[model samples]
Target: MTEFLGSVWWMIVSLGLLVTIHEFGHYWVARRCGIKVLRFSVGFGKPLWSRRDRHGTEFAIAAIPLGGYVKMLDEREVEVHPHERGQAFNHKTVWQRIAVVAAGPLANLLLCMLLLWAMFVIGKQDYSATVGRATGMAQAAGLQGGERIVSVDGRSVATVGEASMALTAAAMDRHDVTLQVVDAQERQHQRVLPLSQLPAGFDERRVAPLAGINWQFWLQPALVDRLVDDSAVRGVLQPGDLIVAVDGERIDAADQVYPAVQALGKRGGPGMIDLLRGGERLALEVTPRQGLDGNRQPVWQLGIGFSESHAPAYDTVLKYGAFAAVPVAIGETGRMAADSLGMMRRIVTGSASLQNVSGPVTIARVANVSAQRGLDWFLQFLALLSLSLCIINLLPIPVLDGGHLLYYLIELVKGSPLSERAMAAGQFVGLALLAGLMGLAFYNDILGLVTR
Candidate 1:
């Protein structure tokens, strides 16, 4: 419950920051264009607090934090005073109106770039892909125990984390991925393995499962950063114990250990016993507990904590002054933007499933997890979210920036404004599309929760 509450709080904060920035873009530009802004709100629904500035623009924080809007004086409304005609939004030229409409998305993009630059300037820790140790039958796959992986699929990998990400991407498509590995003898070898052929029982927790690759990338153990009193792992597991195995299954990595434990309880076991306490190998048993009220569904619980150790160490770290960060920020932001556009195109072309569509619940979960990981992870997550916001808002749909742009273009070509009734119809269509998409996203979230 505490974790959930924390996630909700973070979600609110993130949304508030992004929405304020986005709306402020429009508000500032509209004001500069000589439009009379009636309200500049940080959220939707009823105002929680409001104050009017000297320019008569009402600045407000609204009840709902999910979104925000700006209301400008418009001559199209019957309530517009004759004297206010010059300040009306509808009285603005097409170019001016387009500028106001485009500013919000543009602001989101700018914020994303700035955040990326900040991350680059701060310098993030990097991990190498060398295996410090390897064990079990899987260890005998022509891989020297101390081999270091330098690249995958022709992409340069500076860290173990990068290698893992690249391998996972390759595995999803069952593609044959090439790896450049150097052994303890310093002998370099290039191997091509079909990622889809990776072993099924390979631990996904320690390293991402290669579709066909048997070699496991190592990760540091999970350390107990915090523990819930009601958590099953709390009493049974200690903070310093390095998880070795669950129910006799050799735990090769941190990711492998917890899921294997959870799977044991999920399969209707009372709980699996495990060894920990480092070299001492103390044995402990855990039990499953029902989540959320007496729902009677059992999940693995062991009241203990684990922290990661043996993370890859970087030899060189890059940091930048504010002035030097701009170019780096621009490059990173462009990469992220391009990636998002590609993914959207794939999904639209039927290469991706609708199930990939995530709503607020998934986003909140991601935000929580990213926050737990570290500040760098959180910043990366926010960058991706910002890109999504920019792209989605610019989609040529009604009730969005793109929809307004469409109207402007039509007016420009037709030499007259669209009929009020026609505009209303377009709005209706846009609203319907928006609502339907929201419903689908909500449904997907529910499905995920239930399945979990």
Candidate 2:
């Protein structure tokens, strides 16, 4: 029950805050354009909290926190007083109307930039970009594990995050990506990853395991199979965990784990092992059980089995000053926005899975996990969610801010507003599209719950 409530709380806070940011963008822009703002709401449904400001705008916090709206006085929706006729939203120039509608999404993007700036200024862990192994196309390209990648497609990639962006962009663009790497023996090689033959729906992440490319370089080749019931690591470690770091030392290969484990157990009251499951990294402390060895000497062990495949982990931390962070954040936001748009385009073109759509349940789950990870991670998560919200709202579908802009564009080009009946039809079609999207999102969330 506590866990459930925490998830719900995070979801509400995250979604509510994001929606408020979006609505405020519209409200601020509308007011600046001299429109009579009737209401500024932070949610939908019944108003839980309401207050009319001195400016005549009714500020509200509504029951449903999933979305919000800005209600501007429009002659079509309400009878306008003679004195207020000039301030009616419908009376505004088409360009002004377009700006008002577009502001909400633009606000979201701006918010993402700010959030990212904060993240970069504060910093989160950082790691060098190194290859773990190769699968599928990577193997065909002669890429090997343990190589430190120097660059991708002429872009210097000092970190896995940077490498990932370049790789994904190249793969999605259907272009061969050139990788300059120094192999384990310090021998330099150039590998051309043929992206033309890359699977349609495979994103950078999904391509990793199959392509034997571990950009994060945190995966250990030996997979943890299980723990004995009475073992020291029984509860601390789980099956399928990939050992990341043993004690305080990072392991670059499976063979390196033995020396670290032995050194830690020799003088340690407790042995620390950092592990990765899915995308989450965890640290566990265990006291190895001592037993007689072949020479009748005592040997300490953590009762676990290993498998052939590797377990992966990732960590990064790059900090900058306020001024320095701004450009980096903007660049990061642009790349993420491009990635989000590309993913959407892929889905629309039937080149991507609709199952990628995430809804409330998925958001709640991620929010909870990220919150548990601490503030830096949670803030980063929020930024990404904000970016996604911005992108989705900007999609040219009716009933959305983008839809209003689309209508306004037509009005500007045609020199007249669309007929009321035609506008109503557009709204209905927009609602239908949104409903279908929501239904699909919910279905995907439920399916994820069942499968995960």
Candidate 3:
């Protein structure tokens, strides 16, 4: 119950701020365009807090906090005095009207830049591209421990997070992807992973596993964080022991340690384990025990968990001076927007899964997760989400800013506004299309939960 309520609260906060910023854009632009705004509302339904501005705009926070609006004086909606007619939104020139309509999404995009700049200044510590071990795909691709993965699908990635993002994108679009890697001897080569071999209806967690990649930056001396009671080897190994090697192979990263153990375990039972405790090197004879995965496949397993703890020598926090953060933020935002748009285009063209469409449930979960991570992470999440929202709003669909701009465009070409009946018909169609989109997103969310 607490978890559910936390998600709801996070959703409300996230949506409320974004909606206010979006609506304020319209309100600000409308006023500047000489349009009289009847109301500048931060939410819908009954007014929770209301005030009238000196300029006669009613400002309010309404009961529902999911969305908001800038209610402008339109001749079609209200009778205007002859002298006041000039201040009506309908009296604005076509270009002026288009600008007013476009401002909402534009504001979101701008907000993303600012948020990212703040986040960059605050900084974050992420893992680099060194692996401790390899299994499944990594092993099959002959990726030994300690190899540095340079790129995914030809796109350079400096961090493990970047590689994961690139690989995730590739996984959704095709049956295979190429990873450019540098081995221990500093030799460069490409490894091709066939994600297509996975079962149909592939979900989020399955992608990397099926593609044979589990990455870890920290080397083999991983201190045990926890051992699940259900794990067969839980009591065989105690926490805080530094695992330096598995069997005869020297293990630096956890990635290198895994394949060596799993393969040996398949031969029957545990293998020789070499570990360091209290600065003393020791050897313990052990074997990998037979275990079942989620699919009930019998596999050799080690019941060990690793938590985020820097090995002083391996990782560093990245902080940017305020002066340096702005350009970095702009560059990152631009790249993110471009990548997102490209992915959307692929989805539209049926090259990607429609299951990617997520509803409020997924967003709420993401919001909760990000908020839990840290302020910098939450801010970055907000920036990415706001940018995506900006693009989504700019899509040319009725009842949206993009739809209004489309009408303004037609007005420019025709020398008059669209006929009322035609505008009404467009709005009707737009609402239907929006309903369908919502339905699809909700269905996808529910389907994901059920499958899990």
Question: Best candidate, lDDT-wise?
Answer: 2
User: Which is superior by TM-score, 2 or 3?
Assistant: 3
Give the Cα lDDT of each candidate.
0.74, 0.81, 0.80
Evaluate model 3: give its lDDT.
Answer: 0.80
The CA lDDT at 6 in model 1 is: 75
Query: Local error of candidate 2 at 394, Å?
Result: 1.7
Give candidate 3's TM-score: 0.84
RMSD of 3: 4.3
Candidate 1: misplaced stretches above 4 Å? Answer: 126-190, 193-208, 212-318
| Candidate 1 local lDDT, 1-452, one digit each (tens) | 97888788778877888889889999999999999999998888999999999999999999999889999998676478888888999998999999999999999999998777777778755556776554332243444446777888787776666676666545444466777889878899876655566555343323333232233334565544556787876677766666677776766566676577677766765655555565686666666664543476554555454554555445434467888989978977775676567556745775445666889998888888888867776787787788788899999898999899999999999988899999999999999999989998999899989988
Per-candidate RMSD, Å: 8.3, 9.0, 4.3
Instruction: Report the lDDT tens digits of candidate 3 across residue range 301-323.
Output: 77777666654443534568999
Per-residue lDDT, model 2, residue 219, is 55
Q: Against the true structure, candidate 1 has what lDDT? A: 0.74
Off by over 4 Å in 3: 135-142, 175-206, 217-239, 243-271, 286-318
Candidate 2 C-alpha error for residue 339, in Å: 1.1
Q: Judged by TM-score, which candidate is best? A: 3
